[model samples]
Target: MNAERVERIRAALEDAFAPCAVQVADESHRHVGHAGARDGRGHFAVEIVSAAFAGMAPLARHRAVYAALGTLMQTDIHALAIRALTPEEAHAAASRG
Candidate 1:
């Protein structure tokens, strides 16, 4: 279930953004026994770099990603940590790291 959720998120973001880099981390373990995780729902952290996010506000980018996920939010996923960026922004963040 966890792997499937991750793959779904990866595919959705990959198709919508055409990201240069995309990573989806399962964070459900961190919230085990919590309200959402108790039912086997997925908690995820996603980092995506794509030109589709260029000039978009942070909230807008997040909204776009959430929109791409469609009904998954209600049925499978409970939490999402999004780091959406353009290629240049991703590069700059990488250099800082």
Candidate 2:
């Protein structure tokens, strides 16, 4: 749940996708004594809206996000929950809210 690590994640994703919106949340605290947390890595949830995901399938989007994070996936991050969407999907979601 380190702020620095979270910021790094956000920066990397932004650089890769040029996302219109990105939200990164550390969920490590909830995992507490979980096995992965024991190793000092973190769990994170990310919601990103971008043109890069426009025609991608769900799995492809997740893979893209993973690729964006690069080595961070093996170092700073233990688990990731991703909600990737195209700009139009994000706009639709916003309207619903």
Candidate 3:
């Protein structure tokens, strides 16, 4: 179930943003027995780099991600941690690391 949710998330983001890179990680195990995880929905983290985010503010980028996820926000995902970045920003961060 968790793996399926991660794939759904990745596919949705890819369709919406045409991302240069995208990773969706299921982090539910770390939160086992937590309140949100009780309902069977999973927690996830996404790191995405896309030109679609180039001129967008952080809030806008988050909103766009939420929008792309649509009903999965209510059904499959209990929480989402997002790192939305443009390709240029991704490269800069990677270079520094």
What TM-score number comes out for model 3?
Answer: 0.98
- Candidate 1 TM-score over all chains jointly: 0.94
Worst 10-residue lDDT window for candidate 3 reads 1-10
32-85, model 3: which lDDT tens digit per residue?
989999999999999999999988999999999999999999999999999999
Where is model 1 more than 4 Å wrong at Cα?
none
Over 4 Å off, model 2: none
- Runs of candidate 3 with Cα error greater than 4 angstroms are none
Name the best candidate (by TM-score). Answer: 3
Ranking by TM-score: 3, 2, 1
- Write down the lDDT of every candidate, Cα atoms only: 0.91, 0.95, 0.97
Q: Which is better, 1 or 2, measured by lDDT?
A: 2
48-94: candidate 1 lDDT, tens digit per residue = 99999999999999999999989888887999999999999989988
On lDDT, the leading prediction is: 3
Question: Comparing 2 and 3 by TM-score, which wins?
Answer: 3
TM-score winner, 1 or 3: 3
Model 2: weakest 10-residue lDDT segment is: 1-10
Residue 82 alpha-carbon offset, candidate 1, angstroms: 0.5
